[model samples]
Target: LWGIPLLHTEGDERTDVILGKFLKARDFKVSQALAMLKNCVLWRKSFKADEILDEELGADFDGMAFMFGEDKEGHPVCYNVFGVLQDKDLYSKVFGDDAARFLRWRVQLQEKGVKMLKLEPSTPNALLQVIDLKNAPWPAKKVRSVLLKAISLLQDNYPELVIKNVFINVPWYYSAVFSLLSPFLTQHQKNKFVVTRLGKSTEALFKLISPEKVPIQYGGLGRAGDDEFSGADAPVTELPIKAGEKKTVELAVTTGGSSITWDLVVVGSEVSYGAEFQPDQEGGYTTIIEKTKKISAQLEEPIRNSFKASEPGKVVLSIDNSLSKKKKSVVYRHIVKAA
Candidate 1:
């Protein structure tokens, strides 16, 4: 299962590992685990889950779910953009008359995630899921029905394949819905869930994942089609801006003939941002790189800019959050490229 040899002839160790997963999922209840394993095997054969990976569900479901960068412990992260289903035309096409096709495609995505795992007892075998519910049809009858069925299948058949389920941009109504459903959930299942309200996604995600691995749409330093910086580049840094105060981050350019590139984002609210260069020598002039501009609260992407220097200096990036009463966190990273 999941590309791991399940046959007894394969190896006793592999079989034991597989059994251990089921056992752990059932809290070490041997009989319960065995029954669960039997059900999973039967379901796999009936559902053709192993072959779903070979099927192409096409681009219509592309925006629904996808595997992205890994989390802190190297568990692969899968992002589910529930908001994409808001498109009525596309929604009807995928989840319409019947949800079977949609369900199969969702399983395919899960299988892809499982393929990346070692499925061993020692390694990190589960996935980290980030479900963005912004503008999602949370209250829709069809949406609820489809998702509930999918969740049931995953919980029963997949069995502890997800390390964490982080739900971001959750609407206010969700709490009420969760309250109604919480009693039905096992404590173990409840423990794996994390909920973050709107405007707090970046802050919540940063706690579980590095900013560089997180996508920019979630207020991280990462950007799509980025050529200037890669995942293996310099580590991202975080600075906190106190309410009604300004904070400056300085990147010292010890040598001339180099270009400094930076990516920055202010979480939660609008802030005034600017950049400048101060030469090291006595009485050396300061050069303004970017004039102070107000970054709106709705900004979906991080600010990326570059500056070339001919003299030794320090590039200062300023974030002024004086207008807001709430403290904000800034995620940023910089690179010094030789000219």
Candidate 2:
């Protein structure tokens, strides 16, 4: 049940724990618990969940779900993208109509959390997950279907794998969906979910999680990968900068009116950042955007800007950390497109 290839239910302490939890979950009924466990094994086999950690099976979902730091309770932290799914149609197309593979992705994500937890001094029985729902509108039927499948699969088959489900900025429409999701959850699970209506409800989250482990974008100290967009051709570059440091990335604009699009995130602290346009002529560099704005220190909400060159020249996007004493890392991606 814990994704172990061959569960040694005979004398294996982990399997004993799983059996015990299932028994407890089902009112100490060995028959029901055993039934549940058997169903889980069968489901895993059919779903190809065991192979999810395998390279070929999991390659497509590598970055879709990621594991980072631990929660305040010392449980591994996982952030899933259910909340910010941009294109369900494209997503469905990429993964195809097979719910099994997608379900495998969910299992793989949780299993990845398990692998991370094993790195701790003492392995945790469960992991903490943050499901961001920002910009998540009620999507097409496919999206809803996938969400229901994921929730159901986790709640029923994977018991106590998630110590807590921290739902951030959940929309009002989600309450109805939660009502649907509730039946799938046991009372124990229902108790573990922490729902914050306002994304800015930092105080409540802090009560359970320490600031150091929370992402700065979410008003916490932890830094994590946020909404950074990179194309297959235009990959992102990572830059490290100390206080008072400056760095600029040069984008070649071969045609007049060519567009330069960029997204940058500074981890650990906010810094002044902007873009400059240098024309080919004696036109020198003109500050296209030179302003410092507050940004999250943990994760970044991509600060994106699209500026068209006035003439064939170089477009330089600069970051300045002169204002803060802490060092920070910047994740940046840029693309230059002809007008």
Candidate 3:
């Protein structure tokens, strides 16, 4: 009979007593049973089973506990747990009858925006057969081999769902299967599913599987420092361009009583810009010429004042349509003489 609680803790004397009685009845080594009990406690804490199940099932209970119950003769037996289900029929449907109801519940939860579920690996072989019917890509021989290993591991973990088979090989398919099942799995269970691929393919697979759930920081272009300065009343402005279109803008580098060096940086979706400089006859001033191959808005010139020019003078900059087949150019000029 099933007598395992849905959850357990390290200091629970009742649990220790239960474990001792179970081991003694089976004539099993108490030390081994104690070790298994320790493992179970660690697993429960790591998975936060009580909180996770509560959130997933939307129920209030002290906690769930699991245990490996035994018969009067003290032999290792199947697993069992304690929990109250509102829909007994639904519960039986999901856990019983080859998990037919369970799979359907998965689909239904997906439709309702639920995104993950967990099930014990020993769950009726019929249920595994059904899951295989839907997502198994390997040959029958390979599926059986992998499933047995997975189920064995699941049994060791007892109430925890087994997910190793999902990642054994063919990560793309595994991710796909998990993504499809995400709506039915709990957050903790969903975390158990891992994608083993690396690099671009893995990125693409993740994007394909959970585009909406992907973190925002991973996508999108970053803004340039020049844009922030220009917007803050700096003496520079960004020129706009269209795809294949070119434009030039002027920049003002104020000496502000000291000589400073400046750099021009172009910011565009897909455009490149270059700059050339010419010095004045007095050797105290210089002009910077800037050019762009296509049209786009970019911040150019981090102005640094160096060597006061003493008199009013002008610096010329230009941008050319390098990206266009027809070949056109645009120019911008800035004057940074005294004031």
Candidate 4:
């Protein structure tokens, strides 16, 4: 459907891949897959799906959904934040008596995500869907109905386009809502869903995405503004701290006139953190880069800091979790630049 011929006679890998998607979605049933293909083509022509990309859906929906970094398998990650609908004005606008506009905008986002897929026989042809349900108005009947309709439309027409539907920051009562949705979902679809409760999304996300690719808001090292490192920076290393324990990461400054930058995140709870530069020379002084401070559990952003070395020394980052009964995971990365 996405610019590839679906006929069996085409004999091309792209066409076979397109046909395989529908077949897999319908449990390899040829008749049902063919019927789905026909219906999708018809629906696309009627809904002008091909032309939706050119339409400006407005800035109001900008943060509602967005394409972010890729997953471990190189599939593009699409984040859908339903929390935006907590705004009364936005809630009424998108989920009011008419959901057509909202549906169109949502479909348009899916179309954009689909474009990220390579759709070849070997490459990753699906997007990872992360739906943030934090602060969402789940009790609203109108919003629920519109969400269901959008989900149905996407699942029907965009079969096999998503690797997983991860619902993060889900409330306690979400299980009840999921029970209702289960009837409409196939076993295959059900298996693709992943749900995480409040405060645990960061841990869940890290298992699927790299620390640098994950946004800092979800407890990873990825930050948006004036970042010292980019996507090409060194990979993040993980450190485990047992309850009532301490750990230090040391970065060696082998030469003088060098600069070191680092980012670190402590998942789950508050901890005491500090940094210092220890010189290698005998009887040399130690410089405190960051004062030992009690980082709060509520801190949503990762720690980023830098230091310039005038002489040979090592930058040591210390994390203390003695006050916490639970073990903690630390994710961090560092870069050293020579002058």
Name the best candidate (by lDDT): 4
Give the distance in Å from residue 153's predicted Cα in candidate 4 to where it truly belongs.
Answer: 0.4
RMSD in Å for all candidates? 2.0, 11.4, 21.6, 1.5
| Residue ranges of candidate 1 with Cα displaced over 4 Å | 7-9, 12-14, 231-233
Question: What's the CA error at residue 210 for candidate 4, in Å?
Answer: 0.8
Against the hidden reference, what TM-scores do the models get?
A: 0.93, 0.60, 0.24, 0.96
- The reply for model 4, stretches above 4 Å from the true place, is 8-11, 225-227, 231-233
Please, what are the lDDT tens digits per residue for candidate 1 over residues 134-188?
9887566666667778888988899888999999999998776577557766788
Error of 4 at 85 (Å): 1.4
Candidates, ranked, lDDT:
4, 1, 2, 3
Worst 10 residues of 1 by lDDT: 223-232
lDDT, residue 163, candidate 4: 92
Of 2 and 3, the candidate ahead on TM-score is: 2
Q: Candidate 4 on 1-339: residue-level lDDT in tens?
A: 877776667776888788889999999999999899899999999999999999987777777888878888999998898889888788888888436887888899899888887788899999999999898776556656877888889989999999999999999777777987899999999999999988888889988999888887778776666456765457789898899999899999889999999888888788899999999998999999999998753576888888999999999999999888999878898998899
lDDT for 88 (candidate 3): 54
- Judged by lDDT relative to the true structure, which candidate is superior, 2 or 4? 4
- Model 4 global lDDT (CA atoms, 0 to 1): 0.87
N/CA/C clash count, model 4:
0
Model 3: residue 27 alpha-carbon error in angstroms: 49
Candidate ranking under TM-score, highest first, comes to 4, 1, 2, 3
Q: For residues 1-339, could you state the per-residue lDDT of candidate 2 as single tens digits?
A: 554323664545565566665676677878987788788879878877666777355455554567766766787778765543556654764345756666676677776766664332236667788877766667556666777777778766776667788887788887877887787777877888888775444545556665545555565444455433323366656678887787777877889878777766665557777677778778576756646455654444456678878788887777778777877766666777777
In candidate 2 the C-alpha lDDT for residue 149 amounts to 73
Instruction: Tell me the TM-score of model 2.
Output: 0.60
